[model samples]
Target: MSPPYDLVCFDLDGTLVQGTVFIWQTLHDFFGTDGDRRRKAKDDFHAGRISYRQWFEHDLELLGEAGATRDLMLAAIAGVRPTPGGHQTLAVLREAGLGLAIISGSIDLVLHRHYGQVSFEEVLINHLSFDHRGALVGGTPTDFDVDRKGAGLLEIARRQQVDPKRVAFVGDNYNDVSAARAAGLAIAFNPRSEELVETADVVVEGDDLRGILPHLLDE
Candidate 1:
């Protein structure tokens, strides 16, 4: 049978991987930045005191000050790992002829370093600026950063020339709720909250990513 969906998009941190708030942790772990400033900025952003761009810029500046370097980030990512079934699921999707992509708030460089082996046709992620010497200089936040995941999904649909109704999104956290709503099918993988489960059309809980395939393929 033909693929049920033309595109399947996934969130990076905590969805395709094993953790959340990865960017913050990477900055702290590698650069020795306490991240207290970022915590305050995040609170302010959440409280509507700052725009997402502002919150992101403030943290980028902090990271730059802490001397975040490419070498340091690479060192930090060395200990990270993918979701248990992440690679397997990607292969299954590709074999079935479904286009795959990743839309995430996490840094792109980090994702590439860790998941470079995975085959994804499109990747929409935040970019970090680096100096000629490869030291961190700044960052660029995408729609994923401002709780605009739905918008990201729509943009993907537009680019792929596929109806939004022909897309499925799999995600884990409350942050993914809007994106799920935007897609034709919403699969909550290893759901993080009651709200996420309630919002999803299908919920798959467990460490194995392959568990999600039955619901998806059976469609």
Candidate 2:
């Protein structure tokens, strides 16, 4: 039988990459950016005082002020690795002829660092830019973050000429709830919030990424 889904989109930080909850928060902690300032920017964004782009730029500015560089940022996440069995899972899914994508608010650097060898049909995440000297210059923030993650999923389905009901999304946190609800098959793997669990079609608790395979693949 054909696979139940044509495409699968994953959230990067906690879902695909282990040992990190949010890449932005991880960078802030690594660079010693002000917590108060970070929180304020975040609050302002959520309160509609600032656009998502503005909040993204503000965070990048904070990191730039702290002398963040591409090399340093890479080093900060050097110890972070893909979730256990994540590589194998992706390989299996690809072999099954399912399209793969990433819809996340995490930085592109993290994705490139860990899953660089892997190929994805689409990647919707923040892209960090650097100057010739490797200093943090600026970044391009994604529209598909937080509450908009569901929209990202739809965009992918549209681009692939597939019905939204043929898409599956796997994620692990509250931010992932929107996409989970949007997908035909939603798997909450190692979920961090009750909201996500409540929204998911399948909830698998474990560090192993392969735990989701049975739910996604036909027996």
Candidate 3:
């Protein structure tokens, strides 16, 4: 049965943006001797053992410990342009009448700054707060569950006034599998993860996100 979805949710890092692992590697640089700490914090966030805000603070403190300023963090992410044709594809998809959203595990530092380029209908991401002097502090919506990527989609659908059956989801990693399972169509585009490719209902090969347009809309 085809689910109805006038809406579509997208994953950020590996889906629209390219070279996502660089941020992870950068965090590792900040982690120093306790590199495993990064992974552990991520696991805790995903498993609901800790809130998203707490997990981000704990991990970013480790990242900032190396004196990595928030400016530098922003630059690292800003340097990341979307994958080939990503911007245009998003433009085309939006023009095609599909509601677009950005759901990512990336921090607000990145999305808050650059999300305008993509014009996502809604953006749900982690964040780190700061003071007037620009010192790192904490985030609101204090507790977020990273493992429950699917819940965000449901929320997005409701917020957009789009029917659950009308939504289509796209991603490039294992974390996205749950969102895919929950969406009307689960699409893996130029996917690097083998498991993700296997479970996807549509495998879009190559750089263009426009490829998935046919499935989500009629023109």
Candidate 4:
């Protein structure tokens, strides 16, 4: 039988990659950046006191002040690895002719660091800028993060010429609720939040990414 969905979008942290719930938090921890400041910025963004871009820029500024460089940031997340069966899952889905994309709040560095060889039709993530010496300079934040994740999913569907009902989304945290609700098939793999589990159509409890395959493909 044909696949149930035309496109599959994934969240980066905790979903595709293991060992980090949120890459931003990991970076802040590694750099010893101010936790209080980070929380304040996050609150401001949620409170409409700041835009997502402003919060992103503020985080980058904090990292830059702490002397973060491309190399160092990479080093900070060295322990992070792709989920078990992650590559296989992507490969199988690609082989099945399903469109694959990533809609994440995480940065590109983490994705490239682990799944650089894998290809996605669309990748919506933050971009970090660096100088010739590899020092962190500035960055572009994704608009489709947090509550906007669902919008990202819709955008991908529009671009792919697929109806939103023909798309699937896989995610783990509370932030994933919007996207999950927007998807035709929502799989909560190793979910970290009650909201996500409640929102998901199917829940896979494990570290292996292959667990989601049965829901996407005909057995």
Q: What lDDT, from 0 to 1, does candidate 3 have?
A: 0.69
Question: Which tens-of-lDDT digit does each residue in 94-197 have in candidate 3?
Answer: 76666788777766666556456566787776666766766556554412123466788878888888776678888888767767766778899878778778
Tell me how far the alpha carbon of residue 119 in candidate 2 is from the true structure, in angstroms, after superposition: 1.1
lDDT at residue 29 of model 4 (Cα atoms): 96
Candidate 1: Cα lDDT at 145: 45
- Each candidate's number of clashing pairs is 0, 0, 8, 0
> Candidate 4 versus the native: TM-score?
0.98
Q: Please list all clashing residue pairs in model 4, or write none if there are none.
A: none
Task: Pull out the clashing pairs in model 2.
Answer: none
lDDT per residue (tens digit) for residues 1-219 in model 1? 787788899988777877544556666667676567768887899899998788778877777787778887767666666889888898888888888988787788767876888768778788888889989888788766436888889999998899999899988887788888898999998887687789899998898888888766745
- Per residue, candidate 4 scores C-alpha lDDT tens digits across 104-198 of 99999999988899889999999999999999999899989989999999999999899999999999999899999999999999999999999
Candidate 2 Cα RMSD after full superposition onto the native fold (Å): 0.8
* lDDT score, candidate 3, position 19: 61
Per-model TM-score, in order, reads: 0.91, 0.98, 0.82, 0.98
Model 2 segments beyond 4 Å from truth?
none
Error of 4 at 146 (Å): 0.9
Give the alpha-carbon lDDT of every model: 0.81, 0.94, 0.69, 0.94
**Residue 61, candidate 4: how far off, in angstroms?**
0.5
Sort by lDDT, best first: what order?
4, 2, 1, 3
What range of 10 consecutive residues in model 4 has the weakest lDDT sum? 111-120
lDDT of candidate 2 at residue 11, scale 0 to 100: 96
